[model samples]
Target chain A: MTTRTVAASKSGKLLNKLFPYLLLAPAFILVIVLNYIPIGESVLRSLYDWRGGSRATFVGLANFKELFQDMAFHISMKNMIKLLVFQLVVILTVPLLAAEYIFRLKNHPVLQNAFRVLFVLPMVVPRIVTVLIWQFIYDGDVGLLNGILKGLGLVSLARPWLDDPRLALYAIMFVGFPWVSGVATLIYLAGLENVESTVWDSCELDGARGLRRVFAIDIPLIFAQLRTMAVLTVIEVIGGYMFVDILVLTGGGPGWATMVPGLNLYENAFKFSRMGYACAMGLTLSLIALFITLLNMSLFGKKVDE
Target chain B: MRIRREDLIRLLVLGFLAVLTIAPFVITLFISFKTEAQFIRNPFGLSLPLHWSNYATAWAEVRKYLFNSIFACSIACVGALTTATLAAYAFARFSFWLDKFLFYVLMFLIMLPPIMSLVPRFLMVKRLGLLNTYGGLILPFMSGSQVTAMFILRSFFSGINESIFDAAQLDGASEGQILVRIVLPLSAPVLWTLAIMNIMTSWNNILWPLITLSSRELYPVTVGLMFFQGQYAIQRGPLMAGYIISSIPLVLLFMFASKSFIRGLSSGAVKM
Candidate 1:
């Protein structure tokens, strides 16, 4: 009770902490088992030329070489790049413009919430429902588009939208444009709301017209939202293009017109049972997506945390 | 504040958006009430004889899948919320050697595109005898999504003042007691936000469940919709009806929680 008691008294003034690490133990274990473990397994599998077999030869990088040789794989790469560009334009432009309008009208809560709910409905809707709904809209014989075209005296141009290889990818992209607009619009709404009302008032007082005020005050603040949306849209398109393969009724048909990376990866893994090759495809697509995301972050995103 | 010609243009643009947004659901609704014969005959037109019975039929067909989805969604929500909240509390309140490194690891996990690990996850789940179980279906998504919940909760918990923890400590509160009594009560809003977001994700996730759950009884509504499409390849009635039933919960959720959900997603995105 001499020195030991004195030391305990001094240290006891500090708060005792235990079991803090215990709180994190479960999450740490689960991620290791689920995510990192699979990543490791895929790496190991990538070294083998196994086709779901008991016996296989280890051919490191052979799968990558074969993937490069496949013409469809090359096209998938090109199409992915094209999609990244197209998405950047469509998703970025509409939200930047729409956020300005929504910001100007922020005083009206009812109208604001009404439009927001409507737009974001598609974002929340199950992907298959959207796909099926659009599939009906794009149908050939009795679709909404053809019926409207015929009614509007444009029957000459009413044609099968998904059957043509040249137009098939665009038709698929059409479905994406609206499905994603809701999230961007919401992001814009949030960004615009964050801009001080006084700033807009000042711009207005300085003879800034509607569009001019938007450019002068609104875009800069909302640019962060725009960059975030652009990266998300690119990643989404790359990951979500597989759903297009399901809905467009083409299954990347008319000679692989709408064959995006996800669909290609799916076919390779499941149908072809080339686990190694499929892993290569997945790794490649992920790297490209990562590169684009990093590029956008550096170019447009602010260094500060949100 | 005056209603200029430009104001009218803005309103018109919003009008166009309204139509574009709601048109698909409207189309799906109309076709859902149509007869199969009418649907196949004119997929785009009004039903020759309106047939609302298709909904009952479709529901009976996929009710098992719907039930499974509800069960799995609940499991994931509970699992994710508990684990994320616990870890977030530790990271927010404590000073530890590995805290920063672990936090950065969680961030890295969030950035990963899930499809990259799909093949390996499938193989692992299969080998674990969880191929068609509810545990298999919900566990992977829960594990994958915890990064987000941890991030959100960590941000929220760190905002609480340190004095509260000190006071609780002076009141003879143990770490477990402080967590249960103080931290949880103060973090309700963030918890609700995480719940709504996770519920939506659980409801809408397709690709992972599609690959893992092979038994029809184990499929979620998102994957179950694919079956509707497969069975009704030429008919739109059941297909449209399926869409209507499957999407009602989400539509209602959006209608009710639109503001909170939008704020959550935007805030989450901006942070990332």
Candidate 2:
């Protein structure tokens, strides 16, 4: 085997071993320097009080202390919990049902494929634009919601959906009603497809079809997908601000009713020039997301390869 | 020609949901053609005159921002595609003690939201004198795509028949040649999928571009549209028009590539 390459030396062996690293280096460097390194720096930056282009002054967790004391932050946290609960409930139910409904249309490939395409096609529209379109639909006077209510002769129920602080958060959450994401649906379908044919056949043979088969077999097998959606939504809600920011009527609202931690962190960083404070919130948010991610992996994520 | 009542019921329910899904875009399209006065008079109704001037006006307004977006996002997608392809190939084809460790590290980064490091990233880029330049905006976002794209592409690479590469190697072809000649050609679908995704993420990015590129000229359409809509808050017509301009390309792309695009996002749970 070594005959044709008998002249191989120390450098050749080293180069052979190092070749993979060389190929991997650019991405590794980019990720470390641009993505991962900043994470460490953020932790360091959060401990300092730097603002308005001033020199950094070490503050030793004062930012977090201040964050805890701030009542606005408190409201933001409550709002986030509220949104998270709503998001979790919707995510677990709607997407799974939609996927199941489409999956049951097994005999009709045309219909199944069409519904799948329709469900996912909206993804091409930039999320921000969707938020904006919903903003139009939620408009108090001339908006589609009010127009529909008026058309249905339930005009009394059409009062300023996004304008009322009590209604703003719910209205934002309602934007793309049914909340059955194409991604979640696809993941679920994939999981279902992985169910062994023999297992499914046996279940059918035993008359364990329909909802019973779904609850007993499909749901358990797809528990990993459900857990993934739960973790992803929580992280997304904590990081996202587009919806709240576009609540044009209630811009963090008549009373900070719709304010979320992500939006709050953003406002602090740029709008309030509280860079240090925002960094602290960033770290906290990261830790929360990290904790949830770990919880998911431990609880329901796929078993690790040895 | 006998239709089962159950099948009919399923068809009706499915069709309704499909309509509900497609309606928002349809409404946006019709409303986009309306003049401000017409919208005020009949907000939810069809655009009677079918005024097309709004598109022209919206184009004139957001063209600079659109150019900046295309420039920055495309460059970032290309950068991401290149780096992600290389790293994914390494992870897929080579084995070392550090391979699993490094792969997990990339996944860990993927899991961490950018909110985690938003400020420090800004400062680091600023310190490097990359602030406000297209590269500054492009680089971090490019790196952001590495984890997901690497995961996706690595899985794709690993699925390829390895004997083909072995044959190439036996002919004295280098790893680079094998990757280009054998791997790259086979990787078109995944590559296109990742490229489109990278482009979408880079284009849809707002918070990072907002923080990093404070200069008005360098703003992507998302940031520009945010500010523009904020400026024209009450001008619902013009605002809708701008939203139309921004959405049409993606909507068209989806109409064409919806199958593969949805497949890519669907097959993976960790979509951006």
RMSD of each: 3.2, 2.8
Native contacts recovered by model 1: 0.54
- Give the least accurate 10-residue stretch of model 2 chain A, judged by summed lDDT: A241-250
Best by TM-score: 2
Candidate 1 residues A135-198, lDDT tens each? 7778788788888898899999888998888888787767745543566776677777766778
DockQ of 2: 0.56
CA lDDT, candidate 2, residue B156 = 82
User: What's the C-alpha lDDT at position B54 in model 1?
Assistant: 84
Q: Total clashing residue pairs per candidate? A: 0, 0
- What ranges in model 2 sit over 4 Å off? A1-10, A52-54, A197-199, A241-249, A301-306, B231-235, B265-272
Kindly state the number of residue pairs that clash in model 2: 0
Residue-by-residue lDDT tens digits, candidate 2, A9-101: 666878889988998899999988888788887888899897736588999989999999989889988888888888889888877887877
Q: What is the C-alpha lDDT of each candidate?
A: 0.75, 0.79
Best by lDDT: 2
Q: Candidate 2, residue A193: CA error in Å?
A: 3.4
TM-score of chain A of each: 0.87, 0.91
lDDT of 1 by residue, B200-226 (tens): 777777777877777887889878877
